[model samples]
Target chain A: MLTYANPNRFMQLARRLTRPVWGLSLACLIIGLYMAFSAPADYQQGMTVRIMFIHVPAAWMSLFVYTFLTVSSIFGLVFRHPLGHVAAKSAALIGAGFTLITLITGALWGKPMWGTWWVWDARLTSVLVLFFIYLGYLFIWKAIEDPLQAGRVSSVLAIVGFVNVPIVKFSVDWWNTLHQPASVSRFDAPALHSDYLWPLLVMALGFQLLFFALWLLRMQTEIFKQKLRVRRLGLVETSNGTAS
Target chain B: MEHVFYIGLSYGVTGVILCLLTANTLSAFFSFRKQIDDEFKPEDSANSP
Candidate 1:
């Protein structure tokens, strides 16, 4: 991993990876959607259960991407790897996108199942806070002119905000929220039957792959921007040297 | 059948968001790559034998 920390090498690997990752993601999404549509409707929820195919995966990705951001921020702060900052910075918007999808889909799912579009419950509120934290992290980067200072500040913010992740995860369990507790993840067998379980797992895998594809592309863009800035600075220095 | 609208809307919204994010990232990637290439064009041509 450290050896591939160099931006050029990372870009090479990313270029090689983007195509296969995207292909697999597309395949999974198509098959998952087909299975989701074909599966028998839940005896209780009926057709609305199809919403779970998207909602659960988006919710999973919201937490997963934040964890990615937190780990990348830690690498940036502790290891002082330049790529870590780039990775952390690039991941913010993608994470926010997933978070937004989670919130919106959850609301859509809730309206049909729980008879409400929105609720101020523990699980819902914590995820909302996570969304705001993402926005704040992005704003810090844009507001600070110096990349180093921006990176330092946002790294601290990400690390500190990571406490909310577990709270978001266990909120349903700890509190008497309207939200349901863990189904797919449990010590015992999953609560969901195989019909729904398979499609949900496939969709989750597709969403995760899609996140990686976007993250890689964004990181490449950031590296290019940094290179351009360095080149422009070099040109300015050269012109100044000639003038003097 | 009555709940079909809600289910469709959920999938539609998620699909739209994912598509937009993917498009935006790819667009940015290409734009930045072009800028970098244009910026270095002079040096590249100058180094040619």
Candidate 2:
């Protein structure tokens, strides 16, 4: 995993894979969207049920990306892998974007389906906390001028905030909800019908692939920016030394 | 289900956002690379001296 940190090697691999990724994303999304639309609406939930296809996948992605970001941050801090910080920062920001979409789409869905734009339920509250964690991670990156120190500080926040992830997952399980409980879990079989289940899965897969492609591209950009930052700082220090 | 509106909104929003993110990432990558390359040029090579 750490071996991918070599920027030249990473770029070599990234350039080779970039075209295929875009092609795959295009195919997956086209097919997935068709299936998502084709699925019959719930008799009880009615047309608003259509929003579940989008909302559920977005909710799943928000959690998955945040977990990926946090684990990478730990790997960067504990193992001192150079690429860890880049992966973590890029993923955090992207994850935050996904989380925002989740909340927005959820609210939209909730407005029609649940009769409210917001709720104080455990599941909603925990997800709200997850959003804040993402914000805190972004603030750390923006506030610190020194990238290394910023990385160091945010890694701590990321690792600590991970405790909330499980809390989010369990909130729906532990508490009763007007919102439906988990459909799929590793321990228990999914509750959704095969008709509705398949499209949701495909859309989820498409979203994950898109997430990876975006994360890789952004990580590459951040790495280049770091190189530029070091070069600029070195120039400033040397100019001062010569003048003095 | 409202056939046109929901599907239109979902796909419309997704497409526009993806396009924006892709363009934004590419611009940042190429521009940052150019900045770093210029900083390391021989004429302004502070570390070389």
Best by TM-score: 1
For all candidates, state DockQ relative to the true structure: 0.90, 0.35
lDDT, candidate 2, A165-223, per-residue tens: 99888888799976677886556678888878888888788888888788777877887
Give the chain A TM-score for each candidate: 0.97, 0.92
Model 1, which residues run further than 4 Å from truth?
A1-5
Among these predictions, the greatest lDDT belongs to: 1
Among all windows of ten consecutive residues in candidate 1 chain A, which has the lowest summed lDDT? Answer: A1-10
Question: Residues B1-49, candidate 2, lDDT per residue (tens digit)?
Answer: 4434544565566566567767877788778777767766756666567
Error of 2 at A212 (Å): 0.8
**TM-score, one value per model:** 0.96, 0.86
Q: Which residue pairs in model 2 clash with each other?
A: none
Tens digits of per-residue lDDT for model 1 on A34-105? 999999989998889999898899889989989999999999999998788889999899899989998998
How does candidate 2 score on lDDT?
A: 0.79
DockQ of 1: 0.90
